[model samples]
Target: MDVSIIETSSLGDRSYLISAGAVGVVVDPQRDIDRVLALARDRGVRITHVLETHIHNDYVTGGLELARTVGAEYVVPAGDDVGYQRRAVGDGDLIDASPILLQVMHTPGHTHHHVSYVLRESNGGIRGVFTGGSMLFGTTGRTDLLGKEHTEELTHAQYHSVRRLAVELPADTKVYPTHGFGSFCAATPASGDSSTVGEQRTTNPALTQDEQSYVDELIAGLSEYPAYYAHMGVINTRGPAPVDLSLPAPVDPDELRRRIEDGEWVVDLRERTAFAAGHLGGTLGFELSDSFVTYLGWLYQWGAPLTLIGENEDQVADARRELVRIGIDDLAGAAVGEIHTLVAGTELRSYRVADFAALSEALREKDTTVLDVRQRNEYAESHIDGAINIPLHELADHLGTLPDGEIWVHCASGYRASIAASMIDRPGRTTVLINDDYDNANDTDITSAT
Candidate 1:
């Protein structure tokens, strides 16, 4: 059997085309269906089945679309949580199609209907399994995805699901999880992909942690998942909308900046961890680790020219390609040199956040106001008190409430606070960003006598 991993960077999801002789089974078909179809057309192979490991929350799924295009059977997890699929396959059920045999395993930790597929080896032995978001490279999927309800129960369920597979599957069964390292699905993810059952047993931290520890640690590490998850979940539930393969040309930098100044939306796509360390102020930060394409489509005001704050030149092409994948072709050229364009105008000065002493002095006046732009949960867990909690996604909504004072912002990692600090619109309000790691964080920032 020939298995090809199709990297659909549209929303940082992976799909597979497993071909045994002439039959093909596409797993977790992401939004970019045309690419997969083109691959099949080029190879002259016919796709017989389209399988979805689960109802994805990150991006739209192309399972139904691929099935429609190829007239293949659309298979989803057993519970029929997704009502549109052509068929539902339960745990331990096997589908024998000529040389291809797929055994479905119901892995419900990621979602109630999430399933993993075990493909038959060339010698008819079960060797590889596609573990979707249920189990990533290093950590497991977030239980809060479905929200606060049943989070603990699902975490418990997830633990058992992983343990069962660890013990039941052969030590050599290769694991292909959907989102690999660098994905926001889990923090502290494995360094690389393609791990074996034996390797996971020996090295995976999740396998050893107690159930409570597993839930707490995993929950703590997850950064804010993109605000676009709801829309993507709906799209995945119904199946993906068609994505036009042809993209528009990249825009010029000058044009892009003008748009940003004219009240247009622009998102900086650098790593959140890096952006928090330091960045140009006033830019709405969209860390690349979050779904760039997904958020680029939703939060992106239609017809607004986009200014990309790329990590580096190598990421420029990827940034452009991702924008195009979501029908956003009007990219106002990326920031020319560094992140300075975010605060390019006259009178808006940049001050580096060094230590608590400097920050305390900055906030010593009656007119100093500190802003916190982390998720609601993160803010509650222990954030600098007296800081207004305007989560980044809701920044625009709560902008009216920000006092016209020296606005100093900070996040756990600093990336978001930089984005938050940059977006403060009040004039004469000196902007500052604390380091993402907060090396100089003063306990007084949270507990000081106000």
Candidate 2:
């Protein structure tokens, strides 16, 4: 049996296609089922089962639709209160999928009913375990996602869940997790790219630290996740509609301007530098990239009529796929063409993009107002001295309170800063994007840590 990893880097998550002979089983698929279908087709394998580790709290799961498309059995843990029909599995249940056999292990940490599937050969030789959200690369899934009231209890459960996997599974069993590549689902940033049960024994915090210590540290390290996560569980539980990857109907410049004037979301999918150079006044610059979906979903007003302003049709199409992964379907329309043409006689808004070196030099000549758009915890760890900490997500509500002058915006990387700079740019304010890494700030004498 071979395990094929299907990575969705935007959400920092992975889905797996475990195949033996002509049969395959998919675990934790994203909303875009075409990717999984294409993979199965390429491998010449028929999908026999689609298993969801839990009702996901990040992206909408494609498991239900994928199963329906291929006539595969949809398997979910027994205790989740879901709306759809499926094969409800519980702990100690053995699944026979041809040459591949799976044993269910009740791992109640990430969620109350989360389960990990132990993959084995027909002869009972353990190959690996899919520990979704429970045991990640180095840390575990954050316990506060369900709510703060359950954090402590879930943290305790998370500690034991990791311990249970370590003690019960063979030392060499491969570890496959659904979250923690870069997802906020992780309690902390996961380390490295891959690990095994044996490797985790030496490096995983839950394995090395005492249970109480593990729980305490995990809870203490928890930080803010995206606001969009609140809607993911609800959408996943109710069963998400089949995704619409078709391009949104073309929107004319007149209508695009009308939508922007009427206060609808008109997201611009272009490179950060290009967006900084020129963009529509009210359009958000979410540059089509890996981080685009996470930040866009975090700040997006749920259920709002969203329109796309892309440089080309392909860019808008790509953005649509990313948006659908998080359940942002039903795009109002999309306007694609040169920014100048799409402006419809309205002048394009522009901003200056610079690096930390420019910031350091500017500080020498004048008292510059710097805005750090990173998370509060990140700001506490280290930031430029006197830089205002209005995280990008909070910038919209607090934009009016920002001190006047040329506001220099920055984040750990230029991504959030570019977004913030676009939001803060207006009639009289001078917005400069610090398009550089925050570590570069340390090269000067402007950085400080608490």
* TM-scores, one per candidate: 0.70, 0.99
Predicted structure with the largest lDDT when compared to the true one: 2
Compared to the true structure, candidate 1 yields what TM-score? 0.70
Candidate 2 per-residue C-alpha lDDT over 94-123 given as tens digits, one digit per residue, 9 for 90 to 100: 878888789999998899999999999777
All predictions: root-mean-square deviation over Cα? Answer: 6.0, 0.9
Q: lDDT of each structure?
A: 0.68, 0.92
State the displacement of the C-alpha of residue 443, model 2, in Å, after optimal TM-score superposition. Answer: 0.5
Clashes of each: 7, 0
Most accurate candidate by TM-score: 2
- Which parts of model 2 have CA positions greater than 4 angstroms off? none
